[model samples]
Target: MSKKSRPGSRSRALVAATAVVVTLLTGAVGAGAAPATTAQRARPTVILVHGALTDASVWRHEVEALQRKGYAVLAPAMPLRGLASDSAYLAAFLKTVSGPIVLAGHSYAGAVITRAAEGDPRVRALVYVTAFQPDTGETAGELNARFPGSRLGPDTTVVLEHPGGSELYLRQQDFRDVYAGDLSPSTAALMAATQRPVETAALGEPLQGRPAWRDTPSWALVATKDNSLPVATQRFMTARAHSRTTEVASSHAAPVSHPAEVTGLLLDAIRGTAY
Candidate 1:
């Protein structure tokens, strides 16, 4: 009886060992394949394109906020040259991104994304942050004039002739009033001092090809107190593009003055498009 029991115990031990080996192999395969499956389902990258008169630093807060939620974020410096040239540059940059994208633009960059995202399938959605949404064959300057509330006239800006072309800058004295009325005076002064100027011709250059907003789903953040591009103009453009609109009591520099609200709007666009 003891010998028979011993044989049965050995058989059970062998079976248990085989089962453990199979389980380990299965887990190894699962561990290796899980990341690829998860990667395929990962959230889309968020590219925040800063508008003219400001560099990518304008998206600093949004970048930080988005990163906290595990989203990959990039804020590229725009050439701010001409519409065609800048759009070409942005389109080229989009090529470097590897997965689905939630493309966002602030102020003048909206016009750039409008054209740059054309024909690119990776850009899942467009988020306009108090941005310019020009139509095909339309120019930023033209859109600025569609409404009467804008204060971004010659009075609030300065023009300088560079070797290549003239660049436009927000005047430090009036930057707070025109672009960042919702911000503190000190912060506005710092922003004015560091603001990057856009080429004068960029504002007047017509967006060459079809506007991406015409094809892609879009979201717009309207800064109700914005003085640069008037809220009315923002509403008109977003409405024409059929964009989901969110209004906040912010200035033209919504990204800087209201980063959390801007982040929320961007997240909305991401969730809406990142199926």
Candidate 2:
């Protein structure tokens, strides 16, 4: 991975706190019975949350892909290693938008968006691009640890962690073979090489408050071939969140390798919500 010098440790920690806010600990009712939207409204603000080991740039393909579809996109930078920081930063960013926002996240970021959406009226919908959707008080680790499946993530480095939990970075094979296997050699190499280090502890902690997916009008794009989060685990979370769902036959990094399909789904999300 491209070793871009990460932000200063102190600045990153403060930013982390800023990104985290009051969390909701309950699950809201599913948005299954709402009336269909009728009017053509302002373009919805699309928020893109990226997975572990990646920075905002991972959504480059997605942000551009959605822009061409006539939507205003907000691909905020997230601290992959901090939960409260990532969630709080995202929540604060959502407050600045004017109208409906369609929140989207990939991989572990799915957990971030799930926490960021509580009681925020600006969010009109949610889209999980092969992301995680843990319930209130459920940590990403506990969520990912559910019996039926396993995480397709890689092993931790000894220098990073000594005994137990350490951020498990993705291997080239995970990205090139199972996640974004369909991408060209050149593009895949760039993405793989540019992967970032994540906060190992973020995976083990449960959400502090109510989960946003319970009541939000959410949609899920399941990359069936995803080995990173375990395809079954993705399905498990999607089902629990009770979201409108679509299937993409790619791997974990569908947003990068399958931008066309990923953005196409985003277009459908906009039209479905009338914003």
Best by TM-score: 1
User: What is candidate 2's lDDT per residue for 1-275, written digit by digit as tens?
Assistant: 87665569768887776656322212121232232332236678888888887778877877887777676888877877667777888888888887778888888888888888888977888888888888777787776666444444444221166464465566665556645666787877787788776778887767878888777778889887765667787778878878778888886778877888888777777778745
Candidate 1 segments exceeding 4 Å error: 1-39
Tell me the number of clashing residue pairs for each predicted model. Answer: 0, 18
- Assess candidate 1 and give its TM-score to the true structure: 0.87
What TM-score fits each model? Answer: 0.87, 0.77
**C-alpha lDDT (0 to 100) for residue 256 of candidate 2:** 76
Q: State the lDDT of candidate 1 residue by residue for 1-275, as single tens digits.
A: 44455888899999999999999999999999998998777789899999988889999999999999899999898888888888889889999989899999999999999999998988999999999999878899999998899888888789998788899988889999999999999999999999998899889998888899989999999999988898899999999999999999999989998899999999899889854
